[model samples]
Target: MKVFTTTLGEIGNQLSLRLDSKYRETWDNEKGDPIKKTSLNKIKVADLINRLPIKRVKKGELEDECNLLSISETEAKYGRLVNSIQPVTSVGSDKTILNEAEIIVSKLVMSKGYIFTNEESSTDLIGSTELIPYKKRKKDIDLTFIRHLLLLDDYLKYYSGLETGKTPSQKRVNPIDFLQLLVPNVPYDIQKEIGTKIRKLENEMDELKKEIQNRNKIINEILATEFNIDFQEVLDIKKPTTYKKDLLSINNSFDLRFSYKFNAQKYKKLLSKIAQHKVSPLKDFINEPIRLGSSISPSDYDDDNGEAIYISMSSIKNWTLDKDGSRRVSEEYFEKNKVANSIKKGDIIIARSGEGTIGKVALIEDDIDAIFADFTMRVRISNSHNPKYFYYYFCSDLFQLIVEKEKKGLGNNTNFFPNQLKRFPIIQVSLNQQNEIVKKIEEKLEKVRQAEMALVSKKLEIDNLIRKAIV
Candidate 1:
């Protein structure tokens, strides 16, 4: 006789069961057990809930309540099944409306025991969240222990195996079968110990988050102080529009986004606000006109490990080139696609196009052969401006705001024209002044970055220890 095990954990139960191909391929929903019935206690979801076979809220009620929990209370939130958390909607949610009794009236549609409120809201969970209510929370049987047990990497892997559907989002869990599965009968003292340890780790992580926020606040304050501008005034800058109706300016050209007759005066008036200021168009310091790169054929691409390199939009990251993700192209292919437009030392490139990528600025660092991607704008600095100083300013939030305004479309193809970026406003400081500002900001920010790195490392170690401890 021969035996077969479907999953890694199935080997433990191989002696008890023999699964045919049909049973294994179909996920054995009819008979496949994610976890073998152990010597521990078990209870089905039906056993824990007063209401079995829970139903989704009525259509009318669902629509209204879902709005309250929606991303914006109006816009729908789209998330894949893997990212979806069991929401614990209760009191203290954003824009939370309270009932006359001081109890929270959360508007949400919980389908099944899952899809309930998340960690964001902490007040007493109401509505249809399948959890035992606060008043019903048992001290001898701590539910937090159950959370830890369920979240164990081994358990989740099996839980994921239990999911059945053609697609990831379409996957569904069997409540009856899942709830019937057993976990170790942890003693009350042991349960409290595990709960306390995990909670302490979480609290430390929260402190790390606060440190990051405080550092960012200090950086923003220093920037404001250096510019001799009121922090509130800088924050008050009007948000740019999506160029509704395409305002052609007095120049009578569509090239100018502000050319529309109705809004032309308004646009000019905005630009004029800086006329008395030292700010100038960024083009003033540019040695050459902003240039866009050529699109190379896919066939022209070589392996990333190859001799020649061809940079793409993904290569621009965090104020520097992402060499690992960059592509490679042969010398001949590069020549065919116009080698003159390739990247150069001191060249600044901004991601001019793509979803979530537009407005990303990066500086080329001595990689003359690395060609720029087609969806980017490139420039070589003039002798008048310090490349390092100018590059930092371009990567700053101020420049990002201006570039964001010039974004031309919606969705993945959204982009800002290079020409618009050329005309972006800049505070025309002397070369020495720009250098000093960069030095000042980076020096302070470096300490913040180092501190953040240490905190992140500690978090990873703590999380790993917790996962192993429970497992």
Candidate 2:
């Protein structure tokens, strides 16, 4: 008989099902939140089996006794929802030490997405929940097959729907459901080779992700250290400025109304710098204004309508627009929200609401002409200055210092208006300097984009290979 077959044909082929309760005992919390030694003393195997936070499973019965092991908390330290396995060979009557018998897996609610390993020892499990332990097999299943199965399109669709509220409930893989799913009964030797290949690919992907995260962290650090500014400093600005024109008021026939104490000396100097750069206020930038408390419906929003892309608090990212991930609104919603004419190309999207991320920023792509969502500010700079340079400047320490000193007045809900933006100073620099800065940024960003594309290619390769394997 052929060992390899379609995934559908693999159903019910030499697989054994074992309920969590059959192999392990649960431990309960004797104390309120943190169990004290006194409370632990009262915990008996029978009394705590159903109530304990830890999960314990027996590997094999030795004579009349069963062996137990504990899983290490390594996965938890990495913010993973799983536990790394560490077996406990020796178990005393009082405390259990993890050794050869335990195959540790995370007991947390989020462990379903992680990979599981039991290469070293395959005994019973101890001090874990949610992770399902398969019945001991004469031929152990390949970890690669398990990993691939976890990432399958069908599995992800089902896993994504899992909900874990407040306290821990069994939000992991349902062993019963999984047992019913089909699995390719590849020979043990072939399975191991496949598992090895899968591990190698997984390592490469993990390395790339780490590299990108590190690069981003470096960028953030440069902006903070070299520029001498902190994120909290920018968050301290309390003044709100309304715009007379720019993004929000451009469509109005009458002069835009805004309150501002524009300093004549500063305005004159700023304008002179603009003239030297050969930039015009109207062409260079517009004031992006966002209203507060607007409701949005996503299903009705479409992007190909030749209207400006609507930017909202949800649309802003560190330096890029999350167009694919953002919620869109129809032109009618823009009219309803009264910000129908507030967005423009080469604008800056600024977050004004949502806790902890109130001052996030994203540069709008020129192709994006969406409207500004409520509680977001779209800052459009004029052609006189480089738009990209202006973006970096907003990210710089000097302007952030101004925001820190000015805008403030509420709980977690402070914001900037048009007048506040108009009054905010843009560093007076020659057009040549602005151009130079923009050129350098474009070059650096292009490299980053290329690196990101490579990652995408790698993902496609792996995904395609898995799809072929299951065929």
Candidate 3:
């Protein structure tokens, strides 16, 4: 364990009466302290930029066609911030007009703050109330440098430590407190040079991301070709609010649910088209029944001294298991629920619920003393099937479309149940053919992964360049 001490004067200087050890410990380990005592001068963030007045306007007040930037659209890419543009009509909330601003930062969740540096554009842009916009008051400092500075790991931690609210989601950094933070007064020439280098790296990173996206498309294309169906057409089918279905159709189906999602005609037609190839139900290849994982409450989490790892939905990403973010449970819980929760080599895990997370699939390649959470489901393929082939099939676009059509729930709590998963149609091919397809797909994906890792290294180099600039 680590310990630190600070005086009452230090707490008073923070302008916050927070007495929590977590906040005090973080404040004591300041990231900008070294720069504060350096020979170089320092500047308050307020002096460097003009905080734009918060303007709240109803949706009807602005033109529907105007570009609107939401907090969700803004993201930190590589070492720089970026945002996507959408028409104002897409959002219903009151917004703040972003006029002549050089940078926009999210006030909520300072640790994962979405910061975007605007470029010269002809389109009118407005943002969400959660965003705080600022313009460069003086031409001496670089806004790009400041954006990267705000994104630094230590600085984000420091800012997050200053957040005030009752709960994690409600926590926000006061704009006044944010503006009072200090930054190194790097010369204009050095700042501009560092910004230029960071931009160059950002461009390279963008290209790598595009390459990875295109390579991923190859897997979908391969699935489409093998199944002899146009995946694009499957995606193009429009979902109507109401659709007609014969009574016999409803009676013949296993699922009695009458929701539009479960009985869409266009989806049925697409499935019929896919049925032209030799297809089998997903249940045919699985030896055991599809099992939903056991739930462990947050109170039961033993992060510091647990015997077994607990894999949540977040642990499964891009068809891979990222154990780094997983939590832990006690030995008692692991042993009691091992039959339903235990995962081993050759097992496939799929996220059964949650928006943006459902349908995510990962194949376990090694035996580990870990169990999946309740929001996920596990499938153990029989000896007759190639596990990798089924894993790739689950990752395919066709399967994802099926998931979209089958998932049922209101709002963001949609779920793809085990029954729905069992009914999914899997295109059947010879074991040798399946192995060949998996081999080719794996070879291509390996190259893409290598390129992705290279871009990660480049981002670190850019970060190091920014760190050196401040010194």
Which numbered prediction scores highest in lDDT against the true structure? Answer: 3
- The true-versus-predicted C-alpha distance at residue 117 of model 3, in Å, is 2.4
lDDT tens string, model 1, 91-132?
232232211111111112111113221223332212322221
TM-scores of all models? 0.63, 0.55, 0.85
Q: What local lDDT does model 1 show for residue 255? A: 54
TM-score of 1: 0.63
Name the weakest run of 10 consecutive residues (lDDT summed) in model 2. Answer: 24-33
Report how far residue 356 has shifted in candidate 1, in Å: 3.3
User: Any idea what lDDT model 3 has?
Assistant: 0.78
Clashes of each: 13, 50, 0
lDDT of each: 0.53, 0.46, 0.78
Candidate 2 lDDT over 1-471, as tens digits, reads 222223322333323332232111110111111112121122111221111233343443333333333334442212111224444444433332223322233333433344344554544434344443332233455644445544555544443233233454545543333333334334456556666766666567556654453333344354444334453433333334443435444335233323232321333333343244333332225443333335456665776662435566766666567766665567676666544445556767666655555656677656553666667666666556667767776665444434433344466765555556555555455779667656655565566667677767765665555554544
lDDT of 1 at 354: 78
Segments in model 3 whose C-alpha atoms lie over 4 Å from true places: 1-39, 61-65, 77-83, 86-91, 119-123, 167-170, 214-218, 295-302, 305-307, 335-341, 354-356, 373-375, 404-420
Q: Could you give the candidate ranking by lDDT, starting with the highest?
A: 3, 1, 2
TM-score of 3: 0.85
What tens digits encode model 3's per-residue C-alpha lDDT throughout 88-121? 5545777777766788777877667567777444
- Name the candidate that leads on TM-score: 3
